[model samples]
Each structure stands twice: as structure tokens, then as C-alpha cells.
Target: MSGENGNEEESRGLKSLRQLIRILSVKSGIDEAMADDLFDFLLTVDPEKGISDEEVEQIKGYKQADVRKVFRIFYDLRIASYRRGKHPDTGATRYYWYLDSRDADLALLRRKLQVLEKLKMRLKYEKENEFYVCPKDGARYTFDYAYEYQFTCPKCGTMLVPDDNSKYVKVLEDRISRLEEEIKKDERRVFGR
Candidate 1:
């Protein structure tokens, strides 16, 4: 039935959104428990009439400060948004928060692009540099640094040896290629191209 299909699609979207929140939380160094709680609470908010942080605290039994911190992180990531409004009873200004569905894909695409750029930069560095390693301490250094140190490990005083980084370079190149392909797919999906 069409209703069943719609429900399935909605569930899939929810799952994706949850995964995105988890990834963003880890990337931002937020506690996993807080992120999980925040994600669950956000799901209950009405998109059109967003919920206030105080309401979230009252309903979910979370500390207002902690809820605000998670909301602020989501706002920074463009996953959540808020609007200023006056409380009807108290006439006090309040921020009502809701998920920004329109910007979710854009935010994900932007994050992928950022990661792709970093991978490309690292690939370039790997290809251009000669590396040395300390066998005892497993410390790695660039040729210039190794030369300055007389090819000796600073921590353990072990002699440094040339590191064969061809395999590592290949791995980075592969990752870069895969990420580029994923970005292309996401762009097409997001832009309807």
C-alpha cells in the first residue's frame, strides 16, 4: 500500500538522520549518551511549530543546560534550527528548535567535501615526502626531520630506518578515489542532476 511505502521511507529517513547525528556528535567530541538522548527528543518536535528547550527539559527530564549544548552543536552543524518567539503567558523571549530537513542533505554533502579535501591533502603529502621510522618506538618522521635528528629516534635513541610508504600512498589514493565517487553520487542525488 502507498501508506506502507510512505512509512518505510519515513523510517529510512529517520535512520539516516540518526546516523548523521551520531557521526556529527563523534566528530564534534560530544558524549554519545547525550547525543542519543538529544536525537530521540528531537524526533518528537513538530517541524512547523518547533519546541522550546524548556519544553524539551520538562518532557525529557534533561538538564536545560545540557539540552542547550546539544542543540547548539546541532545548530552549528546546520542539522537543527531555532526561531525566536515570545512566551504567551510570561511574554519572555524563547528559542523554539526544530530539525532543518531542507539543509540536512546539504550539510552532509558539505561534510563529505571537507573530508575529501583533507584526504587529498594527505595523499599529496604522502606522495611527496620521504619518511623514516623508529623500529623500537614505531615513531614516524619526514626525511627532513630525520636528517636533523641524525636518523635517530628522539624518544628511544634507536636508529631510524627508511620507511616504505608506497603501500600507504596507494591506500590514501584509493580512499581519495572512493570518496570522490561518493561525493559525485551524493551531489547528483541532492541536486537531482
Candidate 2:
């Protein structure tokens, strides 16, 4: 029974890690396959240790430039940290990467907040912009742009009318609210305060 419980807990942890990698992949704008490869590579290192860029390139079969791209993505998202090291004999520099799971969790929280901030900006734009729609074709246009056409549908030649975007604004507001709540929860979980 104890063995079964241990296995179950390990499986859950593994699943959660996979999910987090996927989220990190999306937020960092890196391909999921690349993220998975990086995650696997990171898994081979002990949490107390860091891996060199050359070692990672060899293990992942990626060239130095490709490895740099991956490293930048991880670094930008704060999923990993690196420090420069020098070869004693050759005087060459190398980057050592460290991916602590705790850091990854905090980075994910920050990424979510950034995404939510962009969404909020878009929502604000929607709330501020005036929209006009052609009743015949249901085509929409911005206020000044529509005036150039004399407020008529370009496709159907119908006069355009003011579009009531209250529902759209409300929907955006609701989405922003939900994201803010999720961010709060994520912050609480990651920060534990």
C-alpha cells in the first residue's frame, strides 16, 4: 500500500511538471517540442547543480546558436539562471544554466501576470474606441475611418450605424476580472504568503 501511494504521488508530480512546461512553452513563445527537450535536459541535473551550455548542446543535439536561442527563452521567462565560467587552460567562456522548480513556479506566475496585463490593455482599447457597423453586411469600422466613406458599407452600400459594443465591453471586463482572480491565486501559491 505504501509503495502504491508513493508511485501515485510521483506520477502526480510528474504530470504537474509536464503541465508547467507546456505553460512555460506558451508564455515564452518557444515551441512546445523545444520546451519539452529543455525540460528533459534539466531533469537530468540535480537541483543543487547547474549544467553547462556546451553540455546541453551536446545532449540535445543542438548547435551553439540554437542552444543560445533556447537559453534566451528560458532566461527571459526567468525559468532558468546562468553564470559565465572560464576554461582554465583555453580562457574560453561558457554559460552554466540552472533551473530550480521553485523558480519556474514563480516565473510562471510572472508570465501569467504579463499576459493578463496585455489583455487588460486590449480591453481598455476596446472600451475607448468607437465602432460603426453596416447593418446590411455587418461589417465594422472605426469612427474616423468610417466617416471617410460617409458612414456607408463598402461592400453592400448600406449606411453604417453606431455599433453598441456594451456587451463586448462587458465580456472583456469579465475576462479581465477572471484573469485578475487567477493571478491572485497563482501569486498566493507561488509566494506562499
**Which ten contiguous residues of candidate 2 have the minimum total lDDT?**
1-10
User: How many backbone clashes does every candidate have?
Assistant: 0, 0
Report the alpha-carbon TM-score of model 2 versus the true structure: 0.48
Alpha-carbon TM-score of each model against the true structure: 0.53, 0.48
Task: Judge candidate 1 at residue 3 and give its lDDT.
Answer: 39
- Number of the top candidate by TM-score? 1
**Local distance difference test, candidate 2:** 0.71
Which lDDT tens digits does candidate 2 get at residues 1-193?
A: 1234444443564556567767766776667787777766764464455777777777777676656666676676566777778755778987677765566655455545555666777777778799999988789998987999999888888999999999988988888899889878867877786
lDDT of each: 0.78, 0.71
Give the poorly placed runs of model 1, Cα more than 4 Å off.
1-100
Q: For candidate 1, write residues 15-70 as lDDT tens digits.
A: 67667777877777777678777866675566679889899888888878878878
Output the lDDT of residue 84, model 2: 76
Pairs with steric clashes in candidate 1:
none
